[model samples]
Target: MSEEYYAARIPADIDRPDAVVARLTFRQVAIIAGTGAACWLIFTAVHRAAPHLPLAILLAPLVLALTVAAGIALGSRDGISADRFLLAAARHARRPRLMVHAPEGIPPMPSILPKAWRRAAGPRPAPLVLPAAGVDGAGVLDVREHGYAQIAACSTVNFALRTSGEQNALVTGFGRFLNSLSGPTQILVRTRRMDLTGLVADLEEAAGALPHPRLEDACRDHAAFLAHLSAHQQLLGRQVLLVAREPQAAAATDAGLRLSRRHAESGAVLAGAEVSVVPFTPAGAYGLLADAIANENPGGFQ
Candidate 1:
């Protein structure tokens, strides 16, 4: 092969320019010309009206020049005009439009067409996709979308209550567990406001079932105290999740085997760390996601 043949076929400057010229779009040029013309006309009229005020006339052009410079600097839209930006913003604001439905008995409001209102169709709600399809009897969650099949759940411990030595041991054990991981895994911590509704309901039921008046009264008082505390205190619930995902390429029959192996390994690791771990079922996973979403956006599911 010739040495010259190995060189680039084209000059670099031909494909990529060494120096690019800065230019303005039609709208920007029009705006600048119009503003300059209007300012010139105003300045001329003011000078003619007050011929003696020479200082005012001199200051007018200086102020106009400064105003024009500021507008050009601040009104920038990546070298595009403000009109295009406004149009794009208006279009984006129209997404996820809402629809209203009237009751069967009540008559619908008379449709009043306004000149500015464009009758575009309202956007539909997006479909919900759960992380896991279902859990097998062997306790493996089938996350079909991500191409992973595994069992996972959260483990919690009161770190503040542990001694320095205990905390050190716990950290060392967890470090070793992470080093031993041979597949994909995720550790997450989610915090949410504690929901005491169920506890309140249970207390109410217990109070109602109590035969003795004194015991029933005490139960009611305790329930009220708990409700008050929950209302006044900002109680937060923190859940630590450990998710292990095995490769989906494993055979269908082998899914259960892989799940069991991963589950046992993770549990043993947690046990060694002196932390209790709970494996989440498919339903549990779904509920967890729903709760998380709800906490992030109130009434989001509804």
Candidate 2:
């Protein structure tokens, strides 16, 4: 990546700062600007028409001030500049979850205008644009769940190369596994990217500290191998596959939670944790897969 692109990414050392943009909504800016313009125009006209009238001149400042104040007060719901930003805080907050690492000392985020909102009815919380809450681990909410299930995945296999006996065993085992399920299930896939800088970094030590010349070549190869892997990975997106079924549909039917089709034909609920069904990755689906390798001899390790 170019230096500019790297610089664009969030830096590792600095915590994301709170927003500083005090963007007045279109309505607020219009109201204030319009009122200020009108008041100033009127003040100018009055001064021109009544140049001898000291009293009218004396009231010009008050008129301009009142117009500006009214615009600010009415447009902003009475809060000063600070409260306007505070009202936007929720948008930056993420959804609440169970597994997120709640920092030990949840220091309140600082604000420049702590008391600004006392002046008006700032923007409603729902209207702000907010970043997503970035927590994904089993949230505190999930850990507290009354019941949950974990599943494993099965590896992809070249079944066509297997003997008839092996194929039959595999087919039979899969059929039996499918029959074992009962519950509501939802399949979820999580994907992410990783920085491979650490892997590439070991090259320096390999080059500098290794005593054996051959080992240095090996280290160079390792670094090149890692570089190739990183290049491929950069082009390849992460994929996590899950196959889930919800027995919860049946439970919901019996337990009487509102149900929707999991699919048009398959009978799944739109939601409700009770929607329980067994789920597994491809790797999770097949048992004895590792043991069933073609070359496994008596007492030989896989």
Candidate 3:
């Protein structure tokens, strides 16, 4: 490649990738961990009488190897990329683009750099690809997207009602919708445990104002309610699933609310592309979010 081409690419890490240098497979990691543990026990038990060898030398590699193995095993397979964030910054120029903070920060790009690459390097190098921008390891997806698609998280409806027919009808409608899709479609589901720290604080504050005897009763009731809620929540943490058709195959419709002509000046959906994330809930709520995405990005509706 020409020097100009090389200048455009992000510099590879000076250190070798853990996978390449350590020969540290997941199995090796497990072995290293176990070996270190065993070595520790052996050295501590025998080192007093057998002080001929420096035990640290034998164990140092084990510790170092174990740390690398742990990091490799835990790190995302795909590192952060810098395409979509750049595009959004160029296209709309008005929205808050989700981005992973670059290690060295976005740097300057040479004159030969592509517009996309230049955007990723605001002042330094932040690797971001548009397609992967909202992916798990890429930039966090902004809550909104322009032409690509639209999504909203709806609260889940509790299904513990006594009315069987109502539940059956709802499920039947959902099943029919799933069966109706033609071409490329995708569904995403998300769920999360609800946080009630503020609620807990409020309850504590209320209890503090009560008389001593009544406060005990309040505490007991609060504890019981909390336990009950926790048990129920543990069984039913939030989850959301996405169902979508490919942008090109989606039916025609108006786009979601773009931030603003002025605000959107900094961010734009280059194509019918978008990603939104919300805490997961039950299937019905997830289905509603799918509908919302389709509604917001009409052209992509299928």
Candidate 4:
């Protein structure tokens, strides 16, 4: 494969600090220019009509401020200017080029705004599907609305600590495992900040339970040392996941049979690679999803 083919492709609309200046579209520029011209015309007409009036003099600064505000409002749509609001309004209009009406017979969606504002607001896009629902007995995950069932949770080997010969063997084994794969799979490696709350609590408990003063002092010192290390170090833990996906309707088949086959195949491949692997149980998979939703890291072996 070509290097360019494998290269990461960032979207054109991806936000960056310099994008505000660099990514000005034609619509954004038009909105800003139009607002400025309208404001200028209105200000000039008022000034010309009542040049000697005291009120006109006071209104000059106010008119200038209003012009600036209007320009800002019109230009600030979707990072560029207020053209986004105009586009949304245009799209939501009855005779829009493309109109997507709400489904019939269902209650209108709730909005945070008051009723009048809600009515004035443009139509919004439908909500996206949740990333995951829960896992099944076959260690497969029910990815709700995504039309896929997945099984995940795999372990890794410590490659850096291994000798040259061991590393070569590991590389060969991994290559073989990859070559043996017939279907699609996703391999994920995630690194998360380690939480030491439980360890600190355990250490405190152990320290309190010690009978001898010297031992208790020693335990306290050890706990304090651990606490210090936790505070100072950016301790990170890494998890490996191997996800096998099938159709959501595959649930109709025997779950045990499916899980056993997947487990046996993966186990044999990983065993040859000299890597420790464990499959998450249904409850474990659910817990993993829940933890991910809550943004909690619940593991060790850092």
lDDT tens string, model 2, 37-122? Answer: 77778767877887887966567676768665554434433344433544565555663332222334333334554656533534
lDDT of 4: 0.64
Relative to the unseen true structure, what is the Cα RMSD of model 1? 15.4
lDDT of 4 by residue, 1-302 (tens): 32221224787856623324336445545555666677678777877887876866656776776666556544565565454566667777744343232333335667665888876766645432345654555566656554444555676788889766777777778877788775456788878789786898798899878889889899888888878989999998988877665544445255445545665687688787886557777767767675665535422101
lDDT (Cα, 0-100) at 287 in candidate 3: 45
Assess candidate 4 and give its TM-score to the true structure: 0.54
Best by TM-score, which number? 4
Candidate 2 overall Cα lDDT vs. reference? 0.43
Weakest ten-residue segment in model 1 by summed lDDT: 99-108
- RMSD after CA superposition, every candidate: 15.4, 19.7, 20.8, 11.9
Model 3 misplacement above 4 A: 1-147, 155-167, 179-186, 209-217, 220-236, 241-253, 257-302
Model 3 lDDT at residue 278: 45
The C-alpha TM-scores of every prediction are 0.53, 0.30, 0.31, 0.54
Report lDDT (Cα) of residue 171, candidate 3: 52
- Per-candidate Cα lDDT values, in order, are 0.64, 0.43, 0.44, 0.64
For residues 21-126, could you state the per-residue lDDT of candidate 1 as single tens digits?
2455455556666677777777778778887888675676757785764476337476554556667888978754442222223333336855344235223333
Query: Is 1 or 3 the stronger prediction by lDDT?
Result: 1
